[model samples]
Target: MSVIPAELDGAVIPGGCADCNAEQHFRQDEPGMWFIGIAHDDWCPTWRRIQAQRAGLPTTFLS
Candidate 1:
């Protein structure tokens, strides 16, 4: 199980994960293998999954 670090629920209302830094999560588990840190479901925004997919478009190389 994951431990809720102190700083996570500190002064910051939308307390983010000290390990990652996500903007949305429960006081529990998170999604994805590359967890950017558990976020505050009630405070922070959604997780960082779709955001990643929308990042810089993929590229292909050929000779």
Candidate 2:
């Protein structure tokens, strides 16, 4: 579950994890738009790929 208000425009990352459920929260402030956090299971492959991509590492998943 997210603490962010539902009225705020946001995006969802779908996955099969029962825990995290692969949701991302975003909010706009003085600094501009930013994601509050990423919710994903530790063992989720999608999360792994995302982390790899963010770290500038290559991933087997195709865009």
Candidate 3:
């Protein structure tokens, strides 16, 4: 769920989590469509750190 309205428009959609006030991205694009999800990196430091700590093998490692 999201705390902000879902009608925002911009380079990047904006929103806040329903459980917390952390900023978030509420929209995404595919080949020919748009959908909603919590897919941005706007999470708070606590969540980011937690995610980093639980990371698995790199999906891609390029140089």
Candidate 4:
């Protein structure tokens, strides 16, 4: 039930949570990888789940 804010429409990275406003950057110096500039709200559940996954933490606690 997350909705992307109007200002961020069409700008979010593909497959990212709707509540995420993080910017995706592809730097020439770091080719072949995409960078995320996090701008999500601190309390966003989807963002928290993503972080947990990245850290190898269980996501079962997240809804």
lDDT of 4 by residue, 26-45 (tens): 22223333344545666778
| lDDT values for all models | 0.41, 0.62, 0.49, 0.52
Which lDDT tens digits does candidate 3 get at residues 1-63?
Answer: 544444642234355444445444444343334454454345566557658867855646523
Q: Assess candidate 1 and give its TM-score to the true structure.
A: 0.18
Cα lDDT over the full model 2: 0.62
In terms of lDDT, model 4 sits at 0.52
Q: Which pairs of residues have clashing backbones in candidate 3?
A: none
Candidate 1 lDDT over 1-63, as tens digits, reads 335553443233444555344454323234322223444343333434445556746545322
Off by over 4 Å in 4: 1-17, 20-38, 57-63
User: Which sections of candidate 3 miss by over 4 Å?
Assistant: 1-6, 9-21, 28-49, 56-63
Q: Rank the candidates by lDDT, best first.
A: 2, 4, 3, 1
Judged by whole-model lDDT over C-alpha atoms, candidate 1 comes out at 0.41
Which one wins by lDDT: 1 or 4? 4
TM-score winner, 1 or 3 = 3
Q: Can you write out model 2's per-residue Cα lDDT over 1-63, one digit (the tens) per residue?
A: 435555564655464455556766555452444556668878878788778879884556646
